[model samples]
Target: MTAPSPACREDVRRTLAYLTAVGYGGTAMEVWQWLYRPSRAWSLEEVMVALDAQVAEAKVDVMQGRYALAGHGARMADRHERYLSSDKKMQSARWFLRVMRLIPGVRAVAVCNSLSHEMASEKSDIDLFVITRSRALWCVRFFALLPLSLLRRRPGHRTRHPICLSFFLSDASLDLRDVHLKPDDPHMAHWLLSTVPMIDDGVFADCIHANAWARELFPNAQSPRVAWYRRLACLRPLSWSLPFWLERVLEQFQLERLPSEIRTRMNGSTDVIINEHMLKFHTNDRRLEYRERFLSLARVQK
Candidate 1:
């Protein structure tokens, strides 16, 4: 077998450094797929060989089957334990999202961020990216959160499981690049490419097609895997559709509860855009902050 090149070793090193900076530790195969992009293609065996060489050179460290920077051997072990805990959390989340899909107008449910990338910590929220029908946004959210509200994980309370319905979009609003994306937004770009669809309902693929702009920034980002689709069970159809008057009533009720500033942002727009497709509860959107942090670290690394 041919020895891995200097460039290949450097790529592997940089990959580990970046991932470790974000508190994500990976196995050789995880690193391999993450490295499997359009710009710098590496075969599974090539990645494995490069990883082994890096370990030999004291450039990378592996602990409990997880790999990280040479200085983070102990942290990698802790991360591995968290990864194991995350597996059980994912199972519970899957069950919740499964029920969420059965709600009327919900088109898809996807696991996003750290969990999707397989690096979730013990306290990582179960981030879900949802797609809903064009006009049933408020109704969809009300029903979707009805059960989740009971299990809010309480502020500052500890729990191995917590569901975060942070992001949502309507079928007609799938093209988020022009609407939400900013230049050099690595977190958003990586998020688009890494979402794990638990309840596709065919809308997940459409969302991807609509967001082709991500390909320009992250040409090497991994595509959505089909294995998640095969596991979805057919949801039972809702017995009765919400009448327009009832939806309006619910929207108004919800509006009464929302902060005045957020209501001002709504500006009386209550259809799929404000009421259904655009329900974002995470006030502190961290994508920009994370992008700036990662870019600063990358520059320092160079």
Candidate 2:
């Protein structure tokens, strides 16, 4: 119950900031450079600076390691390490998206959170905002991915908004096969029609180019407004069921399209949503006991 040291607190802040900021799942030194030389370019010397007394005090949770990239430049870097630079992240994301797109069964990917690679905190897992080409495939991906390394919510946050890849594919309320248009869900069609090149089989370059344009032109576009609002409300962890049920009810018209395999998972998810609705309707005064325990006086002081 003792308070965290001031240096530890600063380290915690820096760690959170750096993980999201850099986001390449790097070794210790790579993260160090991003934090220290946040504004200016960094040399390996910046990495060494962290070894100093006060500076070292600011990296209590960071793993200790010597810099192998001491020679020079970004590519002379270690083979095994994954360092996420701003450009690198985009390139990496586009690569995966293109790969997913090319996969035979995958119709189109309705990207969500993982594309941007939200800042990862300690114990934070990756979240992929995905939409499968088909409901059978969606079910396959869901079950295939159920055991994968993933986390829904950030540690210390009560929301069950997991960091794992979650789907908003084939609206359970709509038919699965109908929504996607050869990787184009309206906007994607616009992208293919306008920005993407009709290159050889490798539409990778085309996708990258189109994605850039989409990001630039309609940067804020996500899902439709009502659906998005319901999604936002449902993932909040507590009292999630009500909005979830309402969302299902709104979307139920598409149920005829739901595949039998995906139907199983959908049923479970629907029930959870219904539970949340019931909780919201029935519980007059819901006091979450864990919130108080999770935020002790020591944590506040720290």
Maximum-lDDT candidate: 1
* Tens-place lDDT digits, model 2, residues 1-302: 33334443344233223232222223344344233213333333443443333234443223223221111113223222322332233333343344343433333343222223222332333334332222333332433343332432322345333234333332222222132223223223222222211112222333344345333323322322213322322221111112234344533533455445554444342221112111011111111222232233224323
Best by TM-score: 1
Name every residue pair that clashes in candidate 1: 137-276
- Give me the displacement of residue 207 in model 1, in angstroms: 1.3
By summed lDDT, the worst window of 10 consecutive residues in model 1 runs over 267-276
Evaluate all candidate structures by whole-model CA lDDT and list the values in order: 0.67, 0.30
lDDT of 1 by residue, 1-302 (tens): 57997776766766666566566767887676555223466777887898888788887788888788777677765665666766766776766766775787778788887787667777778788887777677787788777776766422446667777756787877876644435555556667778977776677778887888776654556667635533643343333356667677877887788766665655232211354446765555666666565555545544
